[model samples]
Target chain A: MLTSGIILLEGGLLNPNPGLIFWTAISFFIVMLILSKFAWGPIVSMLEEREKGIQSAIDRAHSAKDEAEAILKKNKELLARADSEADRLIREGREYADKVRTELTEKAQQESQKMIAAAKDEIEQEKRRALDVLRNEVADMAVKGAEKIIRTALDAEKQKAVVDEMIRELAASRN
Target chain B: MRVKAISRILALVVPVLLSLNSHVFAVTAQAEAPVKESATAAAPAGPATVAAPEGVAPAEATATHEAEGAEKPGEVIMHHILDNKVYPIEPFGEIHLPEIAAKPFGIDISVTKHVVMVWLACAVLLVVGLTVGASFKSLSSKESPKGMANAIEALIDFIRTDVAKSNIGHGYEKFVPFLVTVFFFILICNLIGLIPYGATATGNINVTLTLALFTFVITQAAAFKAQGVKGYLQHLTAGTHWSLWIIMVPIEIIGQFTKPFALTIRLFANMTAGHIIIYSLIFIAFILKSYVVAMAVSVPFAIFIYLLELFVAFLQAFVFTMLSALFIGLATAHEGHDDHAVEGAHH
Candidate 1:
């Protein structure tokens, strides 16, 4: 066995073959051609399509994100505008209510003052009428009482002179 | 009287010559007797007739002849370069490897070890192809790929779409497989060659030539298919002046042959040169017979070259595929006016 092994080693070293080159080339070409036809075509194209698809999807996602962000920003802006508007309306309403309240108070005070002035004037007129009527009645009653007493007490000229003299004396005393 | 005296002297000389011949025969008979006895008898012994020169031993002469026979150093170099050996049993005797036998087909052959390696390479390619195919089959709706499948797909797609379709426009689908296969096969072969004790089929000139020949055949067929025979011949003329046909035809013909030749040489030289550099660097250890020097100098240099070879393997495959696509593109290009709008539009 050892002798045979030595012989084989020696034979290999002594006679190195070159023909492997030709056969290997043939086989390689055959394999490459067949595989290229069957396997490589689909694999490569599929991969390329996949790459392109992935790239496009990424682009689409990015654009969608940008659009969503823009929309969000617009919504935020709109929300801020609405808030400002609401604040503005509230401020205007408060100012309007304040103005209305001030005007109503001024009107109420003016109406009250007019009513008090009218009542005072009516009271004064009524008091004046009552005083005038009372004065007239007192004057009439005094004259009638004086006439009756004079008629009964004296006759003719003597009576007249005495009455006149008494009347003059009373008038002077009353005065 | 003088003639008679001469005759008498001749007679005396002839008798003496005859007597001397008999004496010589007797001496020869005495020498032959021992040799004849030794020839007849099993145990008969005699001194061997073959004589060695004085002062030099027989074994020493044989040693000298052996030293002379070993003088051809080129044979030793070639043996190391080309020889593939299978060590049937390990030095420790713990493992036994199958004996490698060469199977010859006609004058040519695949060595058992190389055949096994090649078959192994092919099997690897098959698995890779099937794996990639299966991944594609089971691909999800999600766009992204992960892991080895992703990597393989990326490489395959780069070759098919980027290299093949982008270069060879129009009927690129038909050629994608060819281009991809070549790229991967060569890539695999080159990588395998980098392995210890692996034979590089692509490194051989004949291998490269056969590959180039396939390209040549394909290119010619594509041209013929794209343009009829007359148109194809006219393509060779290239719408030049009728008077210039003589010069143009030969030049074009030469160009045709040169393309494939260049392809063959480029692949063969590129692949072989890397291996040669690596082998030569590693061989320094054996040539110098110093482990320390080899470790310090050759190992580092060899490693550097090896890394370069790795890059080269990929590059060579890419270049070969690219050039093939370019050639196919050129062959199938429309005759006469150069309107590359079709190609430009695809890109």
Candidate 2:
């Protein structure tokens, strides 16, 4: 057994001896087979699983980034729309206030004009009534004064006839 | 006028003639000595001795001699192929193992110089595997990868997903480590070969042949395991006439051996060819004896080839792994039911 072991050792695969090729082939086959059985399958699956995990992670990251970008875009759009809407509302409010102010100013001016015209009409009516009253009173006084004068004038006529007789006599005498 | 002319001519001619003659004699003497020495050297070395090939000038001979003295071409080639001086040579001489004799049913194991490199390579693989395995173990959560583990993990995953699982299919998980190790080991060996003074184990036909043979055996074993002995034999006669079995069987067996042989040659040739081209180009500089031209040409050319060699190293590794996987895939494929058809027809 020792001699055989020596022979095999002296002529082993480790050395550049004869049968080295054969032994190397056998040893390689055994090692490959054993490793395949014991270690390979698990290691490979683990590696594959890790790779798949990484790829999926990358895919997930890309999707998340896209989603974030989309959300950002949407937010920007909403902000722009809101800004436009606020601007429109501000313009509308200003126009509405301006319209109300113009209408109010016009209504106030119309009401003031109507009030002024009514006051002028009242003043004219009062003037006409005062004139009518003064005219009636003056006519009555004038009529009364005329009657008295006529009566007085009849008396004077009588006296005058008497005096005329006298004067006629006197003048006849002077002539 | 004649006397004045003759003196002027003499004054101009004397120095020019002397210098020209001196330059000519100097060049001639220098050229003659090497020829004379070679002639003397050749006389005693005998007629059967190969003359230095013609057109090689004395300058070329001297340059070649200097180059030979500095580093022989054979030594350079050998150093590129098989030199392994990673660590400084240790002086702690041989220590024979007493444990080999003590075992009752012993296995004799001895360490040699090459064996030591092989052992070192194995140790490196073991250390790397264990370290990676430990890192894998320490992964508490899968949220994000960290450190060297991430890089190693990525490589392992690529090999598994792309090479092994893709080819080997259902039972591919079993062969991943073997495939990965083979790929990495061959890749490292090829890369090391490209480095100055580093050995390429895979560049050796013997080493590659051994690896290929291993693949061949695994393929056969897998085929046999998948289908029984009878089924395995019937697989060779797949899709064939009954009378064609003799011709087909030998061809099939030969096909098996040829795959590994091709693997050996492909790797060996690819690795050796690039090195030879680079060495030959550099050798031109010495052959020409013109340092200016050599520096201008050879250095750039060699550098380009070296870069190409780096790419080849990875390519060869990938090709070997891919082909090996393909072979394994073919071998483990389902056995055809052609034998049943033949049997039914006979009945």
TM-score of chain B of each: 0.69, 0.67
Scanning candidate 2 chain B in windows of ten residues, the lowest lDDT window is B43-52
The backbone clash count of each candidate, in order, is 2, 2
Model 2 lDDT tens row, B187-267? 766776666435555655556777787688778898898777987787776657979988987876776677777777667
Clashing pairs in 2: A41-B173, A41-B174
**lDDT against the true structure, each candidate:** 0.62, 0.58
Which candidate number would show the highest lDDT if scored against the true structure? 1
List each candidate's DockQ score: 0.13, 0.06
Tell me the spans in candidate 2 whose CA falls farther than 4 Å from its real position.
A1-45, A48-175, B1-117, B141-143, B335-347
**Across residues B136-166, which tens digit of lDDT does each residue of candidate 1 receive?**
6566645555687788877877877788788
